[model samples]
Target: MPQVYIVYMGAQHASRYPTYELHLNLLTEIPVNCSPSESLVSSYQRSFSGFAAKLSIDEADKLSKREGIISVFRSKTLKLRTTRTWDFLNFSHSVNRNPPLKSDIIIGMLNYGIWPESKSLIRDWDLRQRNPVANIQKSEAVFDSEAPLVTSFSSRGPNLITPDILKPDISAPGIDILAAWSRVASVSNLPNDTRVVNYNIISGTSMACPHVTGAAAYVKSFHQNWSPAAIMSALMTTAKPMYPSAGQDQLSYGAGQLNPAKAVDPGLVYDAGASDYVQMLCDSGYNETMIRIVTGDSSSCSSSTSIGTARDLNHPSMALHVQSGKAFAAKFLRTVTNVGSARRSKYKAEVRADRRLNVVVNPSKLRFLELNEKRRFTVSVSGGPLPGNSTAPATVIWSDGKHLVRSVMVVYTDFSS
Candidate 1:
């Protein structure tokens, strides 16, 4: 069967060139069950040299092996996360006094499920158990809450398109949000009701995105020169940690709820640049050709420009996906730039782990004497064997009497569970 595949060829620096010919030259020869012209769905060249085409499994695999091709994979649909009422997040109304909420990330795989009898699915009635939950009033369910609760309509996440990186850097209030809407639209989205008014309560990404962007802008207003990653690091490290309910972990809330006030003064930030990301891509087994496609430049990932493994990207959060059920150890090397209010401050590391996990931070104390000074630290995590789809959460905090820079460490057996 032919599936729509997105062939990633990296970035196309030369936008003036026609990408159809380039794509045609690469795919015209590939055997397709349909017409050759029909197989070429769309050519993308303004930003990248690639195309979306309908290809069978074997054809996609063959095209993926070709040089200059970064990746070839089937496309998956994703639902948008709902909005915050950020006050429900306790981010406060004054957070914007001048500007953020992009936090709801659909983590793990919890879909409504497709045709279970399809050959692609697990073809067994044994696994298809009936849900005990009743859906008698979903269309009539009222979402009126003053606190944070994952709604029944909370969106599900998709399969991982890349390794290591986690979805949704954070989470916010995504329920019972009062936001703007069209004046002519119905309030209840029912045909019988014709309430033509402006400003409707929404609980989707439309309002969720603004919460985070405003938070980022608030951080930018304070630190005019901080990079985008720096702002993200500050936000992640300063998020308020929460205890997960059943069937939830760090993946649900990410680096915790957004804290705009705390983020502006995060003592240190895990900084990353284009070069760091490029090095990570290269170390992860991608070649120079794919790197060129991604960077749109002649950036080389030689050994001399090393920063260690993908785990050493200086991300605010640390995660590990283990395949084996046996006891294993994971280590993350990170560098944090001191963005503290005082340069003479000294920060100490504290690790809080679950009973089944053991965590250690090297050089527990980081003392900085100059602004923008960088310090490196290593986190080594060891834990009891975890069953498939199991995850463990731990909290790592760096405190200097005044500021608390937090990072969530999660160890899971699978990203798609």
Candidate 2:
């Protein structure tokens, strides 16, 4: 099947040159599936000069070489709450809260399920269980608690699926969330429980997921062209690491708490694409055949030029499962593309970890000459494999003084259940 692409043209020159018309003419030559009756230009053209069009892989590559075309990228699907969350993030009351802008955005939630009666959802949600929790009410849920503490029940991870990569990438306010509920459902999913309410207090990663979804939508409202990975990187890199409570580790709160305000302008992002993830699976011992089964594409590790370990998957957080009770050494390579507004920005790395762990960042200094420029570095961590599943948590931060890009690193030994 043909896929959609977002075509971006070079900067406007003195010559207007009927740019829009030229783009349409080029599309007309391609073997597109659009009906002849359809107005391709009128319907597909974007307001910002970029146009979305469905074309075969070869057709897109062919168009990229055309004159005035700056770049062509495949348009991929991006997938995202009440958000009395403004005050929690210190948002100004003067900020515009227009329904028109909100209606254009969609925040996706996956949890035990949402109660339809909650006023926050406004009876405007679709309940679909063709495929796919608990009871925590407001009185028992604290509203103003310092977070980044993984809810006692919020699942933490050694990423059973892939131990090299961190799981639960970030945390958000999940406890005592007052949102719309299902009038047909009980407060808890227990078969014996028959309590029903229009709005109920809830908590868990499911609740946390929606909060982050709203934060992501908030970020997308500011940057429409950002990919899903970029949005995730923004949230992960800009997360707050302040310890909300004791015993919080990378496994507990991957990159830290969700900081929506800071995410809008994350200085740099560790971006990845479909191929990057395919390689990650490859490194996780998934052979080319198995990889195809998951990705639904023949793009196998054999053909992919950029092969990387699961730890080097361009993820915003790093978690390594070290051999238990034995000292170990590990190194993680990461690349960050400059996304800040400055023309030239410099960053220095600073690490904070337990005294037993020795962490070092090679070439601690990074200088980006232009926007979108990427700089790569390696973080070497040693002195791990602590007793049992005990984790040695550390933070690797790249700061340009104006923006702090941080990644949570955890070196732990698996404790068998």
Candidate 3:
């Protein structure tokens, strides 16, 4: 059987026809019977500008050269299942045990829905016996332990929307997780299955979102006044590096895996304000009227507003794409705000990069005189010709010896040989 593949054509560049019409035209042009006769696997017009269709290796190759096409790849099947999440993240021991009130915070999860009957979610005694915290035992033996790893199915990225800012600000445990299940539906999602269980094991990026959502709620519980960006900063900065041997980049496992404990007190944060994002949108070539429509304000981009790149956004991690010459050089401007104790808040910059690249930080030493105080710094990277078309990976750590504010830097340069 011809396998299904997703043919991503990027954003619509065809102005003459509608999205569906364009897809129809493209399919018609191809020799494959992609119309109703053969049937398309799926059309991704709403979420993404792509379509899934059954294509032979040769047909897919031929279509790859089609105008506006970005990438053509085989559709992958991802597997699931999880707990040992909290234990793996060291969330059980490092943080307080008492769970926060469910009413105060709501963890929003974009997952395969929930199985209310799972003991990990709601114990039977809690419902029937009216015991609130009866089966709540934070023991290792009860929850099976495994070496923490990034799921193969979990998505990785060199963030498409904003290449400068890394997507998936942080990571969380979401493998072989035992959670509540939906009684009406089958566990494995097979149509013919006829089993209904209270608890089911599942995994995937969908489950990962909820874990971080819960952690964000936990952080919100402690710092109620913090903005969404600040909470995000805390999570990313406090995340624990994962599978060092894996040799992954920021795009691979983003800010490492989630650490709910250290996140609560991330000494410092690179916070982005609402206005800053608005400015970013403006810099992205959005007109004043369009910006107003989105922001819901009469906010206009004026001469006073600096027209900087997306990397200017005060994010925890840095990904700068430099298109330089023979002597390639670029500078990344970033600012960090002290969010921890003012008395002992002092940090120094540490640079780690490939030998071919020369990374330097200005005013490497940063001293915080008060909480909420902001310090600005620039990372200047100057390197010779990249042997071939290659990306140079680097890291800058702002550490006070107590808190390590790590930033992953990827310099994509095309220097003249």
Alpha-carbon local distance difference test for all models: 0.72, 0.75, 0.73
Candidate structures ordered by lDDT, highest first: 2, 3, 1
Q: Give model 3's TM-score versus the native structure.
A: 0.69
Query: What is the lDDT, from 0 to 100, of the residue 57 in candidate 1?
Result: 95
Kindly give the stretch of ten consecutive residues in candidate 2 with the minimal lDDT sum.
Answer: 36-45
Of candidates 3 and 1, the better by TM-score: 3
C-alpha RMSD of each candidate structure in angstroms: 18.2, 24.1, 9.6
For each predicted model, how many residue pairs clash, with residues at least 3 apart or on different chains? 17, 10, 11
List the candidates' TM-scores in order. 0.62, 0.69, 0.69
The list of candidate 3 runs beyond 4 A from truth reads: 1-83, 93-103, 107-147, 243-247, 289-299, 322-327, 387-390, 413-417
Q: Candidate 1: lDDT over CA atoms? A: 0.72
Candidate 1 lDDT, 12-91, residue by residue in tens: 75545466677777886666777666687767654467788889999999899988899998987654344334444455
- Which clashing pairs does model 2 show? 80-108, 115-181, 115-182, 116-181, 116-182, 117-181, 117-182, 117-198, 118-180, 118-181
